[model samples]
Target: MTHNLQNDLLVRAAFSRPTERPPVWMMRQAGRFMKEYWDIKNRYSFLEMCKTPEIAADVTMLPVDLLGIDAAILFSDILVTAEAMGGQLSFEQGVGPQFANPVRSRSDAEALQTDVVHKLQYVAEAIKVVKHRLQGSIPLIGFAGAPFTVLSYLVEGGSSKDFKRTKLLLHNEPELAHLILQKIADVTVDYLNMQISAGVDALQLFDSWALALAWDDYEAFAHRYNAYIFSKIDRGGVPVISFCKGSSVFAPLMATAKPDVVSVDWNADLRHVKDGLPEGIAVQGNLDPFVLYADKKVIKAKILQLFERMRGTDGFIFNLGHGIMPDIPFDNVRYAIDIVKEFRY
Candidate 1:
């Protein structure tokens, strides 16, 4: 499954293999902070950018060319899988994603289409374009929303602070919740396999909202399905990363899913979490995204501090604990990457 990549630091680190230094990249590396991203974003709606291969490739390449990041994630949204499963999806400028037909009942859950791979052909095509353009310079990551996270969106109909509707479904009717979760899991397995077949070098499962659940609920609703996906996909030696907003607390639970890498949040000490994981499991992130908004000296010091803590550790990747905020100064983002690239073990 190896490709002739000029910069294989990311892939190497993902496997918990020793490297000269930890490879660096940011979550949301190709998004709104860059004026170049806005130029393309202005030309098309967000979904349009995702659906169009050329435009998606254009966005996906920005970080690689501008910041010299070690990896490039495909330009797409997690909810696209839900949309393919019969959820009517849309995005308002600032309101984020909304689902017109939220699934609330057994009939609504049954209506979601599990045969979604062909419907998401645009994503696979975008991956092909991105791969051709990369020419094996760096790895391109393909991803899907973990089943519980997608189910929350479908049940809540959009973003929610309390996830009231979603939790109610879990409590009042556990059977329906599992029904919907299984459907999303089915689509996720097929969707991720489709990405693998399209030539992505690695895969990530984003359980972005996992923080919203308690231990028992998380284990029953989120962790099991995530493990199911890891078990079923034909990864073909392509490393998989399991990321969640609550990984600082859930790192142990997340590791049980058997991802090569577990991407954690800023709340925990990165080195401590790494030390607690099983042997050969790599770690990515825990830096506060706001560090990029600090002065150059502050940013440099913070980056150095994390690296120093992880000084002797193997299988570390430098990244923000979460996605970069849209308004973060682009110059500061570039400076942070420069600092990481210049550092060594």
Candidate 2:
């Protein structure tokens, strides 16, 4: 059903080029909402599904077929990178991602490799399969956890509200920690490069837990390392968007890495963010995911409100501040997208 290969919404919406309605893709756009995903997932454990290129590719295209989003994100867990590294990984119900062997010293850092493309062939294959099936309908985005964030999983081993173990690793073992970050950054760049090579049209580095740190800690442990990865591309040609979900303090500064854009979570004010950032770089998101809980009128009003803030901004990509939560009524997601498509801006 998908026809032309060259023209796609994400490529244009990401830059807010004037030819179309603003582009819209949710953060976890290829997630739980679809029955097909659930049906496939019901047949296998999450990790198994991820390792199966056929399954992963099918799920990646679910949002494209169901929600009509502008782009498709490869369907895989962010923590998969940790598993690809020297660490062991598993996902527990309600508990989130867990790692068995966390990086603690320089020795631990030395254990990782930048050859994840070779190591994680399934992920690459998944992208290839998804791209072929997409028939040029939309761009596919490939992503991994940012070094600091994936390392947070390595240090903490799983979901942590405070990220205490990660901070301790940074605070108590600063120099060794830098080595770990450097290693993770190296591998992340490789992993993302693999995705790009596999035909990903764009990439997003998700550091969803960054909000847990204060500015100084974020600067020391996070911002610089991420910059290092984004800086190294041959001509730095790929369109990369960095989204540090919690670090509202450093969200604006994230653009310094020269990513094509930066995505903000719901915590920050779009007006303040839009003004704080200089032009040329595109901006995506910062809308509260829970706002979808509101009924039609409120959703419409707030959606328009967001459009107003983004008015005149040439490269804004509309997205949720975070991901759509579990059991989010189908209508809410559709209404939000309709608002985005209907907006004159």
Candidate 3:
């Protein structure tokens, strides 16, 4: 239980502490892009892998061993919390995640349990397994979906293009939307704290659907709850990252939420977004995930460009703007990581 971290670069950079180099870790570092991951996936269903502590721990360590990254994020789905809150979740081969009972009404929303510690204890168990295996070599990141993103799934039933169902509910039943968001915020705080208690070094709140809303609507819904979660969580001095995919326009607003770091999506300029945020907050990414598909020369150039943009900054963590694409060549990812590790800024 004595965590003498061999490499605390990620943790230090997250806190805006000066470091020799920027730490690097991808979002979906442990996913289908690696043959080793598929080797495990072939043996267990996704849900099974998540629920089983040993399997989840192994998956969490994959990127660190295979790709030489600075962090190991726990291998668990954001929706597991939703399922634990009584949404009945399942996965399909190509269709992605499906919910047996989507929350579309006040009655449906009322059914979600607020006490998440007991229901989602598997995640905390998995975190302990990861920490023991990791031996404090590098940080372990734990995360959950921001309330609005989780609400998108609950209202739309799955992935959405327009989020029409969710938007309609937010507009037509404002009180209902608030009720659901409040419940989710409460659960998110407890669930995240449970992960921290089990020994995660940092946490990230992923609002993948934040881009769907205009700034005004985002403030009304996503920002409000994100701030609430930040306010309530017991962080114990660990850094909390607020990440809103494709919403660089809200960097200043995201800063207002007061997370230690704000992750930028690929569509934004890394330098521009960082400059926009307040002085104390650190910035995470902006490299397009598809940049890996290009040749080494291009990848190196792209990596160098990002480094140069963030050259003088204290808290830069090199990463793809989003998760690594499944088709991205494994060798290319390795080369990219090396480029990042080798660069001197």
State the C-alpha lDDT per candidate.
Answer: 0.93, 0.78, 0.90
The weakest ten consecutive residues by lDDT in model 1 span 1-10
- Ranking of all predicted structures according to lDDT, beginning with the best and ending with the worst: 1, 3, 2
Candidate 1 residue-wise lDDT at 342:
91
Error of 2 at 124 (Å): 1.2
> Candidate 2 lDDT (Cα, whole model)?
0.78
lDDT of 3 by residue, 220-266 (tens): 99999999999999887689988888557888899999999999998
lDDT of 2 by residue, 1-345 (tens): 122446565665555455455688897776676566678877888898899999998888878788878788899988777787667888766777777776766777778765665778899999999989988777888888888888888877777888888888888888878887887788787888778777888888898888888888888888898888888743234578889876357866687877777888777777678677767777788678888888888888887888887777777788888888867777788878878877775
Candidate 3: what lDDT?
Answer: 0.90
State the lDDT of candidate 1 residue by residue for 86-167, as single tens digits: 9999998999999999998899999999987899999999999999999999999999999999999999999999899999
* Predictions: Cα RMSD each: 0.7, 2.5, 1.2
TM-score of each: 0.99, 0.93, 0.98
Task: List where candidate 1 sits over 4 angstroms from the true fold.
Answer: none
| Candidate topping lDDT | 1
Total clashing pairs in model 1: 0
